[model samples]
Target: MDPNANKYLLFNKLSSQDAKKKLESETFKRTTLSFYKYVNLKDISFYRDYLYREWDKLKVLGRVYIATEGINAQISIPNYNIEKFKEQLDNDIYLKNISLKEAIEEKDFSFFKLIIKIKKRIVADGLNEIDFDSSKVGNHLSAGEWNDAIDKGAVIVDMRNHYESEIGHFKNAILPQSETFKQELPMVKELLSENKNDKILLYCTGGIRCEKASAYLKHNGFRDVNQLHGGIIDYKKQLMENPKLENKFIGKNFVFDERLSEKISEKVISFCHQCGSKCDMHINCKNMSCNLLFIQCKKCKEKFKSCCSTECKKIIDLSENEQKILRQGSINKNRFNSHRIIN
Candidate 1:
């Protein structure tokens, strides 16, 4: 697919008039909620098509993925249409009343497009069914309970990628030195295998990954396993409800969308990887051909011109035609050549 051709379809930056009209004409405010389930789906393409048609009619917007493994969704819907949407979900026996995590920061139009893509796995673990059982998942803990576990010396592991963890994580959480979600699972198991019976706490951006992860850990003979009830999104809401509950989370929470990240607290826990400067700004490569996401300090940003490194900056400086030939897909595989970009 041409990136430029689908830019408007992928994201609709609402005009002021559209935003005002949505607010005024809609009977109730919209809520952003996310949820995921890891179960065998008979036909992923059929499910995707059904959801696309059903949600489009209800004016729903957000990203959704259906796979042979299960479904993961981050959606926004008007309050009036909430019941209808729930009905649509419940129409399928597999998705009845699944707990949904409401977004901490609700925007009028957070998503302009309703995307439902089919994939092999919902969370991209790259593992077969025998490796992990989603049916026998881990213990779910509330925010307050999670805090108590942390206070009681439970080893907390950030079950996300290196880059996501670099931006924000539990104050003293153990982070795996892995780039992809698939690698983090076994690495986490090895790191905590010695303390099988010890209380183990796990958390991710929206709690979807942790669901299956906790199960995998338990299946591997870890006796005590627990996960955040609604993940960090819920934790943030709890903090807002009680200002006294601040400082539990130490840094920013990385998000997948354009926002890149959201501030969990005033504390800055991460430094720029390139310049060793105090910074938490996560930016993708300015090069259109290689938009690899990474964190860079202001000094490094000035030097590299917002590219991942000098090499990427040089690539972007190439003429349009030359850049096209360089990006023929195979040649660009290892071009960025920076571990910092992955971290």
Candidate 2:
């Protein structure tokens, strides 16, 4: 069904929960995948509208964004229609030969709707086109190569934000404190300013951020920069395929979905912010007014009823009337920051 054939964002009318349940009950399984490229797209609207109509027929669900530069998508293709989806993509001149990374770990409800929209840039890094040459990105290192470089003393850096790194990251990686990628760009420059000539390694959730980040670093006169070929998702797949590939990356990897996280190693590297116990599970505060995302343990989750702090806990405990009034003037962080931006 072409939900948006007659209007804009027609799928928004459907209840997300309702659509999710329908997709879950389908006979065929769902295969979650993501990919990106730096090709120039002329008509953003035509590209977006065409994909929405065609992909929807194949029972594809998930988010997709097309910009003047390229596309960034985290989509789920129905098992039966996987070949059809691929065939259509390969046939398209712009999308042909693009790499698609399948999720190493995916749930049935990873996504529930199909959305395609036009954006300014595929990944917003707050960089002008004149600043860096996107074509001249860093070297792409495989899982084995990345591991070897780290073993040989390459300065590893986590390209994700502080909240993401708090749950899990490769050991000895320099994780900046900034929340957004825009802020992270300059912060990384300053953190490694003195060692600009040394070997620098970067990795993110799915490699998109690292692609842009590596280029930015190189533009800033950094020498010998490298990035994981497919980010942590590919790294985990490699470890599973080869038992001898000692998993240097510890703890859960923060994801942008209902699953929220995927475990890479058995080791827990972070403590719950509320109780300080060894935990890596992330939960949003229950209070709609202040739904800050933070790591929380089972004990703390139960004690605080899933709220982040005492202030938020009290707000959630109030009557519905009072809670609504309080939310009128406050920023409603009830949704995940990443999900909100795409939607």
Best by TM-score: 2
> How many backbone collisions does model 1 have?
0
The numbered model that scores best in lDDT is 2
List the global CA lDDT of all models. Answer: 0.77, 0.84
- The pairs that clash in candidate 1 are none
lDDT of 2 by residue, 195-303 (tens): 8999999999999999999998999999999999989999998888999898999888887766778888888888888778898888777787777777889998999
Prediction 2 global C-alpha lDDT: 0.84
Return the lDDT, model 2, position 68.
90
Q: lDDT (0-100) at residue 124 of candidate 2?
A: 74
Give the clashing pairs for model 2: none
How well is each residue in 97-188 modelled by candidate 1, as lDDT tens digits? 78777776653355545678888778878656675666787788877888889989999999988877887889889989787788888899
